[model samples]
Target: MPAFEALQTVPRSGELVDKAFSRAARAGRAKEGIEAQESMLITAANILSDNLENVVTNWPDFDTVDPFYRELADAVCRDTEGVPGVDALRQNLSEVGWASRQIDELRSEYQGRIRRSGPDTARKVRKQAFARFADICDEVEDDLLALGEAREALKTLPDIRADEPAIVVAGYPNVGKSSFVNHVTNARNETASYPFTTTQIRVGHLTRERIRYQLVDTPGLLDQPADERNAIEQQAVSALTHLADAVLFVLDASGDCGYPIGAQLELRDELRERFAGAAAADEDAVPIVTVCNKSDRSRGIEADAYMSVTEDENVSGVLDLVVEAVGHEPELPFDG
Candidate 1:
């Protein structure tokens, strides 16, 4: 069967079976055995649906409640089991609840007393009384949201397909890195008329003729600061170094501003040296493809001898050069 047909039909068939059982159960089939069997079938169908959704959508199926809740419950049980202070912790929580109620009662009493004394005392006491509770509430809300967002962010990280050819693009600021990505993959990434537009690494898949490659567009590298570096940007660089099958060293042919062309060329040479050393040691070391972009803009900087482009030429020649640089056939199919 065709892949899409298989994807669509299998899930629908499972849902049909689930619906059949559900409709029967809802209608007067209240026998304990029948209802139990139907419930089991429904649960199985839901689990199948969740897995299928994950496959089709290329995302973690977090919308399904059962698995997440089950995992949470299991984790709680594991952490709480055989711990010496488990009972003590529960007791302390109960005591904390009681203490909180008592504090509220005492606060109410103080407020009543202050109200009788004077308006100034009443306002001051009330403010002081609730300040700690308000602070606690704010902290709890912030912590919970932070935890939720952290979990969500963790889920958003891509699951690398085994043996996929991952191509990473790296460059200094205003090097037309994203423009090159868009040119090759037609990715529709956020491109701008200025520099530093790509603040984060944007990953997309390109299937040329049919060969699939994972392309990553990393944020432009700025000179490292003394106090600290952008950890996220560093991670982006690390991803290219470690996970990529090939790295495209994108350079600005225009060299319009910031960072001398000589410096940028030296950076590419250094990268090539490092990559060559790694390739010598490890058979799987990624290759480097040096590409000078923005050929449409006129600048006096000398282009790389191997893959130079004219201002009027399109990106196909550069892409072809990249394919050759990686030692892959330009017409390779996607089946691999």
Candidate 2:
């Protein structure tokens, strides 16, 4: 559930135009001669203008959006085929806004013309207004279609709260990241697929001292290097950079996760360097807790913490280290 969850389904241009005209025709039928023409013109224009404005207003302003959500949205948009990028989305919204204003102007202009004309001429003026409305909708048909695609692509984003302190659980495949999260957090973990990627991420929550924490496990997105990633994957990694308060880089030093310990550490180094640049620029150093999972099999490598998820060996201790590294204070209801 992203901020885009609130977005209403965008109507196709032809569908919207047809609905407005059908309703306008009903309004016209209820009146007589010039009044009927005037009624139809007003009804059609209002319907088009209001609906277009609603579409534009429903979208969050990308510039002001929380960086986590903004980056997530951008990634989703970029990965989606035929869907435009964030800048294009903003431009489409601007075009829609302009169309709404243009419709209002056309309504006023044609209403004047209809008022000055005789009954027969009034009908012609209304017809002209209807033509213009149809043309305007046609002009933005692609923009509307792009918006609809964006909505479908973005609406499925995992409902990770940007306001909450988030701990990203990252590592190579089969590193026990999800298992660790499930073991520590009693909350149900949600699995969601990112657009265009086979990768699915898990989000879980835990509360300590009444402070809720979000645990995110991105399987494919954060499991590798920036150089190995496509543009869309890099954008998704950027989203995590904004969302994470701290990172738990799981490592299976026992070589049970298919990847060798050295390779795993290399990935860890890549991630550390990635976060370091972000932390420096933002002035918030995201601490990486190297967790050696499957300690029962082999705790061959040195790490900040060691855990065996299946056997429940030092699992809680590992969580304690993560929470401490996050260092987020619980909000007090009353000031001292």
Alpha-carbon error at 194 in model 2, in Å? Answer: 1.5
Which residue pairs in candidate 2 collide?
A: none
Q: Which candidate is the best by lDDT?
A: 2
- Measured against the true structure, the TM-scores of the candidates, in listed sequence, are 0.46, 0.96
Candidate 1 versus the native: TM-score?
0.46
User: Residue-wise lDDT of candidate 2 within 163-186, one digit each (tens)?
Assistant: 789999999989999899998887
- lDDT (Cα, tens digit) per residue for candidate 1, span 1-336: 111111221223234334533453454244344333333333433343343333334322333323222222122222224332223223333433343354445444544554464534544554444443334333333223322333333333333333556676766766766666766675464331111123445666677656777667655432222123343433334334545567787676566636677777777776666556556667656677766666566445554422323333656776666555556454448796
Q: RMSD in angstroms, candidate 1?
A: 17.7
Where does candidate 2 stray beyond 4 Å? 79-84, 333-336
Predicted structure 1: clash tally: 1
